[model samples]
Target: MKNIFKLSILGLGLALTLASCSPEDPIGSKVTYYPLITVNGDDFMSVEEGGTFNDPGAVATIGDEEVPVTTTYEGRFRGQTYNSTLGTSVADLYTASYAATNEDGFDGVATRTIYVGNTGDLVTSIEGLYRSTVTRNGALTAQYTDMEYVLIWKNSDGTYEISDAFGGYYDLGRAYGVGYITPGGVIVANDIPTNNFSFPGTQYNSGFGAPSEITAMTVDPATNSIDLTVVWTTTTTYTFQIHLDQVQL
Candidate 1:
């Protein structure tokens, strides 16, 4: 009976040791994993008004294999009419959705945003008052600085106009005559006025001294900002850069 009892205890100890040596349950044994869907390429895009939209395509992945996905786009011009009081045309916000489901019945989704507008209507899109910072010789100086507000509007002849009050010598207003949009979406000023000098609010002539020209200009709709490189002749030829922030009002 003693020997039998000792053998039973020995068997129980061996069973416990074998259980401890067994491998752990497989990783994520109780968790369910779903396929991951990723939309490739630029999620945001632009299209000309009345133009067809082309999908950039997307991909869905399940484990190590690629799965089929469906992509769809829907857009409408939210504001179709122009507000004369506001001097701005309504913008069209476009949206696209991508969706996919794996064989295991898990679904994934992605989305995109787009802007649709007329190709040459930048003048209307950018008509408003803007806060500007003019940097000359890599520094902010009192002379030739119009750091407050600049006005931009669409002219009757379909060109764009920019008015920078106190932008010229002796605090005279600098009126940029007319600006047109290039095929590449750049805004080029027709010519810089050399003799235009007037105090904006007081109607006083401050007298202009030299000629200035806007050498280059670019607009970024994403940031609501305009960057300009302007060249002017004074005692010496000087180049300045203007960074403008569009004011909502």
Candidate 2:
């Protein structure tokens, strides 16, 4: 096993802090991560500032190009003894081919290349069917997996929603809304036209607290990772850097 240690997208300072000795969070010892997006060669896309894009790599450039980086060893699951490997390939959400490797000593990797244009040539990779492979001893088995609920940003309402009802749940007059609650027990979705709401009286189904703001959303040009940053209020904030490849199924 390689002593791989890198920083989480949370912050460079946080990464460094974790790299040294961290007791606040036991998971801090991990440094390497599976990139949510990655790039190779001419395939690329342009993302709006604050929008989310997914890919892999250490750094993302402005042109949607990702700098390729490698892990010393495969990543392990939360509590599993297995190590999983990810890669860039042609099989992807939009189009590309790649696969993740597991126990069989086979290289598990996947990749997809996209094109970017100034005006009409802009393109992005999307997700496709879920594919899985299992190998025991020397035998390999394949399985088709169903997708889980995907969280989406609603442009019209300027809120977010996570759904699992196969698209029919939100088709009617019901949709989940997110917000922040004030220390005084008031909940509101900033800039949204609805009144302060709660689980029963709210327009949407989800509420955090008040003063939460969308911090940063962008695509790294180097790794094509979709990074998100949000400030729940004056005192609390959250950031996420994710690669699209991790969303398989």
Candidate 3:
């Protein structure tokens, strides 16, 4: 009986010892890992007008394992018709959005800007003389009448001269400016020097300045006509729609 009692005590002690040495439950202390997603390839791309855009695709990963990801794309472009007058092609700007999502609910998004331009020189394509008309609609609409007969001279060196001949005659002494066309088919006008000039009968000088801006320009090669939008600001902003026909110099 004593031997059996000792065996029972030994077994109980062994059980308690095993219980103490065993690992604790780690449910609350476990760390959860999440998958990461990334887009692959250039964030900016360019294509010719009506050209095909090939997607380079993307990848996702969790630790050393590559996870499968789904991708989607969205695109936007200005719907301008091709110009036939000048035999020049109209350039268009397009933006594409790429998105990737992993099974772990993690996602990534990337954007690319595409410029569809003609194969011609950007500088030579925009050089010419243009006639502009101004219209006002916001805040100070009725305070001014439509101004006509504005002139723009786009020179070969990417420099331009503007004459705000409000009543069919040049006034403000022609403000000199510089500008460039982007690969994405956008025209950016840089700041022109501020000029102080007096009207024909005025004794005091009035200050005239040009605003830096990005405007839309379309070329029609067939008609030799270029359509452009110019935004000018002084005390208030004025938008001018210009139709430039290459004056047979």
On residues 143-192, what C-alpha lDDT tens digit does candidate 1 reach at each position? 43544445454444544545532223222223332121111112333432
TM per model? 0.35, 0.20, 0.33
Candidate 3 accuracy as lDDT: 0.40
Q: For residue 53, what is the lDDT in candidate 1?
A: 54
- Top-lDDT candidate index: 1
RMSD of each: 14.9, 26.3, 16.9
Task: Assess the local accuracy of residue 216 in candidate 1 as a C-alpha lDDT between 0 and 100.
Answer: 61
| lDDT order of candidates, top first | 1, 3, 2
Give all candidates' CA lDDT scores: 0.51, 0.27, 0.40
Off by over 4 Å in 2: 1-150, 153-207, 220-224, 234-249
Higher-scoring candidate on TM-score, 1 or 2: 1
How much does candidate 3 score in TM-score? Answer: 0.33
lDDT of 2 at 75: 13
lDDT of 1: 0.51
Instruction: Give me the runs in candidate 3 sitting further than 4 Å from their true place.
Output: 1-35, 76-96, 117-119, 122-249
What is residue 16's positional error in candidate 1, in angstroms? 99
Candidate 1 residue spans exceeding 4 A from truth:
1-124, 141-146, 165-206
Q: Of the candidates numbered 2 and 3, which has the greater TM-score value?
A: 3
